[model samples]
Target: MASTVATNLNTLGRTTFIKNPSFKATPLNAYAKVLSKFCIIPSIEGPLKVVQQIEQQGAQTVLETVGLKKKGYAVKSHTLVKHNLATGQTGQVTAQDVSDAEYLAPVTIGSPGQTMNLQFDSGSSDLWVFSSEMPADQQQGVQSAGNSIFDPSKSSTFQRTHGTWSITYGDGSGASGNCGTDNINIGGITIKNQIIELADTASSQFLSGSESGLCGLAFPPLNTVKPTRAQTPMVNMISQSDIPKDSELFTCYFSGQSGNSYFTTGYIDHDACGGATPAYSPVDSSQGFWEVKSETACINGKAVSRSGNTAIVDTGTSLCLLEDSLLAALYGALPGAKIDHSVQGWVYPTDTPITSIPKLEIAVGSNYFTIEPEYFGFADLGNGYTYGSCQSRGSNFPFDILGDRFLCNIYAIFDQGKCQFGAVQRTSSGATTSGRPVDSGTESSTAQLVH
Candidate 1:
């Protein structure tokens, strides 16, 4: 059973070989082995597009151009490539506005390049995919996912480490395989000698989806690889001098519509921000998540009482889940909103005026980000017709989890260089709205459901 409430556990699953079930990060030995050396790789200047495609291999170097001062590391920004739209219907009801639950990009593995569409997640850290080693039934299940399987035997660059790998998610969905190193290409950026997990066994949750696998974007501490930990692709980029050393920042702009979401590495898009000033929040990476401190929340400009609230900001999740007491205070502020225990969330009449609903806002720093009525109410699921029941994009969780529903409206930046997370309202200029569906989960831990 896959939990609808997507978390790090749901994405990476549990690695059996690791003794400790709790979050424990091994020291990044790969950083020293890969990034310590500073070299000048020539840059290939081209028209500024979202994602730059690498036709010919350009030398990798730190970005030092006029207008941009020479900082710790040169920033390299990559526009997020959008995959195909995944569509379906629940009776007559269909979310034409939010057709997918997640976003995915193409990642080419091996020498000849068997490209697979992978969901880029910021929660868990592991790059596992369905491979040639999987059983026939398992391979068939995910056949449409990657298009073609990654057969290590055929690749000249494949180096088998023969290290066994396995991971089980909180929702019971999991994958396991052998570990090895190979070349992985994303957009125009290529990582050489990259460690990849070749899946031999896969659960239906993964096979049933259009996405072939997942690419983690968080710190290495949350990596699920066993025996010896593996370095994530993002770390490989920074260590290999593919990006700036002092510029370890990644920004995500996930849109409600398919093919509109995009992310940039190294640089922040000031134009897509609502305000010139961005609110910076400190992150506690000890939990292997971009966890930030949220002081309080407000509804319709009215203050809602709350103590110290810590929120895990994740792009992999679809809803804005809160604890029981905290959610009670939120929904209590709404006039017609009521707890629909069956869905483990709140619901309201679909015909209810969007503007009539009180606005929900969360305080990060000195600034506050509002969850607009159109973004917060989410989909209409109760009845198939025009207006029946509208589901609130919120659920109950032990700890607060801010998913894509809450994040899409804001410009989210994960800055490792300063060990802080920054946010601002998303501006439409230079920003896209296209996207694809990624991971789905259930209401409770181990329980599976989809939005």
Candidate 2:
């Protein structure tokens, strides 16, 4: 059944369309012969073994560095399309359903340029993708899921840096590959000689999804590549003078409804924020992740006390993570909600009434963002709860995770230059009020941030 879900992801990837021409990719079969020929670069049996050996070697010895890149300067913005991959295991997958689960953007790589849908992550720093080295069984989703393997052998400008890279997620999922340099293009903006991680071994989690790779948008200090660390595509563009110095920051706005969600590089899209003035908070980039102060949280007008609570605005994470103490206090107001060790979080009875769920609001600086009941009830446990057995929105993590589950309510901007984060209400799509009617007293007619 899990493999079937993975297969469905592949089918969804191939058929998804992008509104932008630059990020549009050719069909997989269109270059099958070329990719097949390139497959000879890494012998099938040795790829995974090589990756394991590299991991065991402890640290990599610097061999040699090649090519001093020329800088290109210009202020520009490329609009990215948000793609949602559907897996049938979930109930009634819709634009809103998966919007909070995963967010993917189309990226073009190599000379002839093959397009791959990659997750834009703000927590880590390393750009990696499925490549010719991926085993056949794991590459099943490549064709239908819009998952494409990068074949450096086919690109005229591809340069092998002979470096190894590896990344492991908090859930123990990981990928390892060889590093190289290639031309990467997004929404017509091109970043020449961008570092690319070609995965030779991928864990089952990656193989089971439509995302072909990840574009880490966080600070460069978090990169895991070996020999020498590689810069993120965004950092490369910014440091190499590829984007206008004045407009180097990027902004992301995710809308849960049919309305558009976009990732704009180099500038902010004010219209996407629904005309709401952004309330900015300083981010602590010294630790690699986009860390910010989450002053406090309130439930039903009662304040929840927390000490030194900080938040990491991570788009890659599907659910919001909070400390165990906060989780207890937050879910205490709701009936039938208990910690489910099996899922590693709190779960509520599927039959619990929506009105029984209390409102949750968190403060960032002086601004407060509220999440309604509909957004808080995460997913239904398949054992017949349908709408009743939903996971608690809060999970136990070392620090607070402001993930897509909470982020989709506002337009989020990460300004690398200013070292600050800003968020505003998304205008086109109605804020947190979903499926349920809004209470006239607590809800505003127009979506906007409150102090």
Candidate 3:
């Protein structure tokens, strides 16, 4: 029965497979991956403690750049500790390594179709890739990692443009490249002459990853192209005359079980929602994210309120991050749950029964959807502890972020034409039942979900 629903959802629209073939769900790895999405480099001091420090500082910089806070907002800085492998001692370090991405989807580019797996990020707004134009050493490293590199010379449809793009992370690592336009396709939906950033130089962090690049789904204003900003693929899809007016939206369904997650563009997967109507709230894209108001929450069926709070629905992030007070309140309700500084997040004994975890519900507009208890435990921290999915957004970040941890429990919709975000609860019989990871197979493309 579940297989039938999954098939029906895939067939209803242009769908793309979502998977992280190399990702392992360890607490350190999960936390590091989430930090990398925010451009934060995890420190070698310790897994959890350093991540918390880095996030506090990095979030402040990000919030300030987006105009969410005053330029000189007071932010505490932590000295990054670097361990010397040979000396077995820790010292101050300038840079830290990035973790592997959580998920990636196949995107076809150019005339003959050069398909590369890209990390689809809703929190950002740039579609950039490692290209053939990069330095030989960098290209070889990226290629050796089983990642595809785009060669503009091979694609007859590719056209070079005047703009240049560069993105630097907090750790001094960055990517810089030239710009071009070509036919780009995802889930069988093609957008011609879409702006593509071809990286000629990339940091080692990006070159070692399985993903070729990133497909940012946020608003156009967030695009980082120099001199003149370019429209993102999502924006181009909406403006293109070839795409139908009603087909301007995209939906994401992430399964708890591997090999089942898929993304659909051009229509909603009603079957994935189990006949429940999606409740939507107007988006505030001024800050260039899928932002919506979410001021209320319920923990263990008890009302918890915070006025004027908003959340960014970001699929790129691995865990659901909320304000510290909200996190304290939620975790406080669960017996044995405590803020474990060792992991720099809330955690409980691994032996605790699932029924013992308190119920948590977050609001989307006026409607509140319950987050299944199965998602309560995020990653396993060896030594009899399990990290909680709900973590502190910290003092620096201005808004709460609803990442895959919260997203897995619902059928999410990103309506570009309407400028709103919507979601509906998934029925018990849905493709995924928990946040636990399952063994996955090798990557493959399927037309079963394509329009």
Candidate 4:
């Protein structure tokens, strides 16, 4: 019966169109805060293994806290690992893990509508928040950061649930919490009975930000609820009877400039793309991501072919991560471009002429979109070098990640009902390179680049 239900959900189809409202994304500008949000990508096998370990640990912890034990359940041995670029070593460490969150949106929850800032993440699928249920020390940290905490007691419609959830990222940062159901509103769209994870414990990293929580836009299977998986807000939103049949998709527009980024649901902003229609590609959600295949990339207007390169359209990530071979080919064409081990990523001399930088492009199905040269220089290294926005995924990570660096150049669409990913180039002058310029004296000296 469970298998049948899952199959039916996966095979649900989209119907015709209706227009809906959009929400603006608030860009974070504090250099220190932005640096703290850099995402550390784990090796190919690391995430799955870590997730399995966390699930088992979370289930065990929940049982112990509730004073209940399941028959024949045993804890499995597992270790959380991350690469230390500064030390050139792999080590076991517990640190505040950071997600690649650059933008935030205001979301309202509960009956009377308690609004809080939430980082919208397409790479993850759990809607979690800092809550009053956490330890006093943790609550203090959240307060210090000026972030709001969800007080379920204040919400008349809040309903407590039996499930618990815990999740650890590749960077060893994690959050564990109890579950509840409430009404959630985003951009004038309301989703009833949305599962909300209220954190009882959170790593210090999450407590150091203004954002109170995360609103995950990924597929339902990635939700961390235990004993029974719960649907994400996006899933619930689509399932709502009031939502228009045509509005089962969402679109993201990152202008690379502050105050201009926003997202729309149930409709596409064709004006943003200068009336260009998006080129669509089938999405493979088996892995619970917006995954698609890319076989070609362009360097200096020259086509470079590579096969079996699956890419994830992840807005949660800040940089564009490509396969090693493709990265080498792209960087090799530029003189003095090298992967600096100190930073553990590619960097070029700050004095390098922008005209000398080769034109770069990545394909989405049959459509190829150009990545502007300005985006190539991601950050200044303070020592006469600038970091490259496009980096290698290393030999272990199995797929390419088209993150914000790529998304800034196009209008991206995630059609859940149709199981498709779409993109169209943004030719408007309004779209600019990401990141505001800082004085050379205050430039970031070290980068936290992990693979």
For each candidate, the alpha-carbon lDDT, in order, equals 0.54, 0.56, 0.71, 0.65
For all candidates, the clash counts are 27, 10, 0, 1
Model 2 off-target regions past 4 Å?
1-101, 135-146, 170-172, 257-259, 349-355, 382-397, 426-451
TM-score of candidate 3 on Cα atoms, chains taken together: 0.84
Give the per-residue lDDT digits (tens) of candidate 1, residues 369-427: 76766676655654521111112212212235576767866877787667788776653
Which prediction has more favorable lDDT, 1 or 3?
3
Candidate 1: residue 52 Cα off by (Å): 49
Q: TM-score rank, highest first?
A: 3, 4, 2, 1
Look at candidate 1 and tell me the lDDT of residue 324: 51
Ten-residue stretch with the least lDDT total in model 2: 41-50
Rank by lDDT (best first): 3, 4, 2, 1
Better of 3 and 4 by lDDT: 3
TM for every model, in the order presented, reads 0.68, 0.69, 0.84, 0.78
lDDT of 2 by residue, 1-451 (tens): 0001111111111112222222211111111111111111111111010011112133221110111111221111111111222321212111121221256788999999988888787876778889987788767756454467888888888899978887543223458989889998875667899989999888664665557788888887777787787888777777877655555666776654443667776665544544455767788876577888875676676655454667778776555666555566667777777755333346667677867776677766545676656567556666433221112222112346676657776767787877888776542245322111122223322221121
Question: How does model 1 fare in lDDT?
Answer: 0.54
Error of 3 at 413 (Å): 0.3
